[model samples]
Target: MSWTDERIEQLRSMWEKGLTASQIADELGGVSRNAVIGKAHRLGLKSRPSPVKATDAKLAKPAKSPAAPKPAAAPPRAAVPAAPRPAAPPPKPEPRPAVAAPPTPDGAAPVPKPDAPRIVSIGPGGFIRQGPGDQQAPIPPAPPRRLVPAKPSPEIADKTSLLDLNDRICRWPMGHPGEPDFHFCGEAVNPGFPYCVEHCGRAYQAQLPRGTRRPPPPPPFGGPRVR
Candidate 1:
């Protein structure tokens, strides 16, 4: 609604009296609170404090009185002394008497003492002992062993060269290559072998019993020597 001169005058009077915009709007019909506030602002009417803020200030609780300083703690009291106890009596000593042996009758024979025990040692070197009247003879060194001569290799009269080699012919190599005598045994090969019966005998031999076998020779000082 338009702000007529009378309505503007009434709004000014209510605002100056500290009445809210809503209250002024109710008094002047056909106008809203916003319109009244706008009219007041144009007229340069003084602004009023908010009613909500005023009510909050009135209802706010007052600051609590600084808690009375707690009374100072009471001072500690002095401790009392305890009575002294009596000492325990000393313990009595135990008795231990000396023992004596009975005297022997006349013409009686003296008792004999036992002989010292002998110490026996057993290991890779063999059994040995040390004691009086327990002497052991020195062991004799083993005798030198004689080696049996090896059988001479069979001579292949009809030697087979590499070109003439076949499944049915002996393949045993003889004499080093690059030599005029180098050749393979020409004899018929044994059933399942690539060499003749004589060559196969040389190729495979029965293993000797463990007791009759010789120990391997020691390696050369610098390293192993090629044969």
Candidate 2:
């Protein structure tokens, strides 16, 4: 059976007893959690009220009673004999006649063979469930996407790289240590002769005179390396 009013009430009672949604769903074999939540919300189902103690119930009684009181002092009256009233007639009995069962429709009594693929609720649990044939709620379609390309920002492009951010495009110490003009014992800190702060060079060398070092060599690329 679907989650009818009675089933919702049962769920409310179970909730009052502290059973969780998953527990309820498990007991139901496979009722959807959303279904339970929706039913509870729509029906305003809530945990049962706490039981009131007998003493508390008595304490809540009104101080003033609504019943009228009888006179305290009363005068005596002469005794008189009275005749007894006649007995009331016996109550009329209800006529319960034999009733016959309605005739079954033709072919309905054959108990047509059960279909092979049909699913059945095997557990004896009290929870309600939806039919396997019931259509599931549809999944929503994906949202439309923007197709705009990312444009590079001129402000960022114009920002200069810090001195320490040398990406090492220079092959200044062209040949390795042992080659000619390798300058194994090299030292030109700013020009980063041997070890360009990366310590990639194994040897060090002293700097050349003012007009030395091949006029700071052209940037391998025809473009300028700095502004």
Error of 1 at 113 (Å): 46
Model 2 lDDT per residue over 87-113, tens place: 999999987564454556773544334
Worst 10 residues of 1 by lDDT: 149-158
Q: Which RMSD values do the candidates have, in order?
A: 24.1, 45.1
lDDT of 1 at 83: 88
Per-candidate clashes come to 0, 5
- Determine which window of 10 residues in candidate 2 has minimal summed lDDT: 156-165
Model 1, range 22-83, lDDT digits (tens) per residue?
99889898888888888888899888888989889988968778888889999998998978
Off by over 4 Å in 2: 47-227
- Local distance difference test values of all predictions, in order: 0.80, 0.57
The lDDT, on a scale of 0 to 1, for candidate 2 is: 0.57
Record all residue pairs in model 1 with backbone atoms less than 3 Å apart, i.e. clashing. none
